[model samples]
Target: MLAYRMRHRIQFQRRVQTQDPNTGEIIVSWETVLFSGRLDVPAEVLTGPGRELIAADAQQAETTARINCRWFPVDRLELYTWRILWDGRIFNITSAETDRTARQEWRLRCSDGLTDGQ
Candidate 1:
């Protein structure tokens, strides 16, 4: 049997959203970057939060992207507040609410073209 060992001491999760700039439509391309301080590892993925934003027969106009990242502390042993980046803007979201739930899932949403309708 292979012994399982944690290669890195720390781990993190990052969620990102990409959208079209001109039409405000969601774009499926343009990979997002995610970093882990302790693990020194990075990964990228598509289809999150605003996945519904993508429509058939649609052409990307412009691009807007959002990223939500989280880091877990070794001592604290708890889910901490997360940071997010949206279209070159950075914001923070608290994990206070997560404590109340058994399982928590965070996501970043991107919407540029479609609106709620006036």
Candidate 2:
């Protein structure tokens, strides 16, 4: 995708646990990992009539974002622990793909959830 289409700012987060020193309680939170990235809507979302496409997409699943960011090494085993936040919506990291050939960028497939991350 062109850099211009990546106008949205996306943040990467991971689930983390911390101890409340005084209360001895375990605190769970989403910690920011990579600062932010340029984001873009996948082509499928823009292929048809605006209203009709949105209506059809809504029936299937929550919003999905294709986040494009400069290449970075990500531990594959920990993919499930990540989340992407953009425009105030927090998304579960459904999958992550790397551009091994060029090693110039990586994309993430994220889906918004209704539970805790919301």
Number of the top-ranking candidate, with TM-score as the measure: 2
**Candidate 1 local Cα displacement, residue 36, angstroms:** 6.8
Please report, as a residue range, the 10-residue window in candidate 1 with the lowest summed lDDT: 1-10
Which candidate tops lDDT? 2
| Candidate 1 per-residue C-alpha lDDT over 55-117 given as tens digits, one digit per residue, 9 for 90 to 100 | 556743323333222322322222232333332333332322222342432223333334210
Error of 2 at 5 (Å): 2.6
Model 2 earns a TM-score of 0.64
Give the whole-model CA lDDT for all candidates, comma-separated. 0.31, 0.59
Q: How does model 1 fare in lDDT?
A: 0.31
In candidate 2, stretches whose alpha carbon ends up further than 4 angstroms from where it belongs are 34-61, 100-102, 116-118
Query: TM-score for model 1?
Result: 0.21
- Residues 23-80, model 2: lDDT tens digits: 9999988767743343433221111121213343564335555666666566855866
Clashing pairs in 2: none
